[model samples]
Target: AAWKAFLNVSQSIIAIAFGAWAYESLGGTHGTPLESNLVAFFGLAVAFFTTNMISVSIFFVIRNKNTFLSVLRQVVGPGGINIVYGLLASPIALIAAFLYDKLYVGGILLIILPIFLIRYSYLSKIQLQQSNQDLLKVLVKTIETRDPYTSGHSLRVSRLARFIALELGLSARRVEMIETAALLHDIGKIDSVYAEIIRKRDRLTDEEHRVIKTHAVKGAELLQSLTSLPEEVIKGVRHHHERYDGKGYPDGLAGKEIPISARIIMLCDSIDAMLSDRPYRAALSVDQVAEEIQRCAGSQFDPDIVAVVLRGETLEKAAAQIREASLPDVVGV
Candidate 1:
């Protein structure tokens, strides 16, 4: 991440410098030498600062490969980069045209700089997005390595949550947030408490349960440190275990007080856990698991979400769909 940030900043500076050099060389014919130099310098500085700030912010904000690419495409489209470049070059372009009597050259530069700036910003964003995705994949892999039974769990949870979000008619951006949050929801389990609990498995003592419950809080803390993750993601990690009633842990937040992203993940995670066999017990049949979920609705689970899950063909069908959607994404791991 740090390397990518450095590269992004460096590339932006270079692009700005190159653009200013071009403008100074071609547009200074009728302007006083000092006036032309100052205009060029100011324009370059503004371009550099603006692009650099945006690049760094984007690196932190976007972690998905495809989604980040889409956002970059939109920002670099005809109007996006052009807008930034125009803003940066307008003052210099104007001074050269009117005050410096370099109307023809300044006018030409004003027309050209917008396209250059837009292209530079777009390319930089693409690079940063790719780097961010690579970093996240590494982090997820590390998490999976530590929990063999739950290998690919994060990816599965992310896919299932995304499917539910889509079915619930959420906006594309909102769905994406849920998906990303699911991917990192259990990341805090990388801490020692989680390791100790997992090792103990079936024989957990009361002290162990207390330690395990801290994972939600720890996960939230870990995610909060990452300024790049969306606020919804942090909230989901902090409250995914929270029940619809006021009985859940960490903050004991209830019902609507729990974030939608967390609720979506809670359902998905529970379904996965029930469907998958663990060392302690055999995997439950789909129908039986569904019955359990149905029984728990409005108590352990959200009634509305349970209704949505059950409205589908059957528990077996829902389980099949989750497995189908997630397996390919996770198989290699």
Candidate 2:
């Protein structure tokens, strides 16, 4: 992220410098104080505007979890940023043609292009957000169908995750993404080698355990194909199982290396899973589950996130709600 920011800053500086040079070459003598002042002001504005667009683009990319190209395309799509830019630039282009002729046309083009580019970026973000939600719904449905015992597990987890995110002061949009990711965190189970273990109300085989563990990787692969999701979201989906002590699967990312969203999902997922009965285990009481989570802080969970959850009144209510909505033994069987 820092590198991207640096590149944006550099590009803006270069553009402003080139614009100043071109203006001077086009008979605006820098020797005159008034001309110099105008050139400086224009260059500064261009730089400022360019940097502003870059910042917005970055934010859009993070918000949507989309590739840069996708973001650009959306912002420019139909009556969006592109149209706004075209409206602003068309007159400038016409004026340039009439005044200094084609020599100044390039300047007008540069000014107009960023408009379309930035608009496309913003639009792409909207598309990405919509796509993520749609994909999440599908994933959650698939997981729920596979395990009748956990029919509403994903939904409860999402609610719990969202509450925790809000408690941590995450933005509404971020909380939404975290919720979506939580809803689909177990999606990798679709390809699980332990499908029978999940179905049979008995102990899982060693091989079944191994297969169950592959869900994180599978879920990440599924999300990666969408192309509209952000890297952080993908990481969260992939590493939700990772322990803070670096004992987790796929890549054993520990502590801060684990994406914050993933950390949020991990705690919520565990809490929900523990509070709900599974074929192999009885449902733990809310107090027991909370104590377990607190005991494992800095080992299985992030301490800071655990702290937030502990203080969250909504979290306890969410857990109790999950218990109330518990599935019957027929669903588990």
TM-score of each: 0.61, 0.58
User: Tens digit of lDDT per residue, candidate 2, span 1-333?
Assistant: 997788777766765566566555554554454433555544444444444455555667786444554444344443345445644553453354344443475766766677689899999998977886777777678767867778888888888887677656565557777877888788777765647767877776787787778889998998899786667778878999999999987799999999888898888888877887777788887789879999999999999999877764655676677757864556553
Off by over 4 Å in 2: 1-135, 192-194, 327-333
Off by over 4 Å in 1: 1-120, 313-318, 321-333
lDDT of 1 by residue, 89-186 (tens): 55654555453354566666765677689989999997987797668767877877765777777877887787677556565667878988888888
Per-residue lDDT value at 210 in model 1: 86
Local distance difference test, per candidate? 0.72, 0.72
Error of 1 at 26 (Å): 45
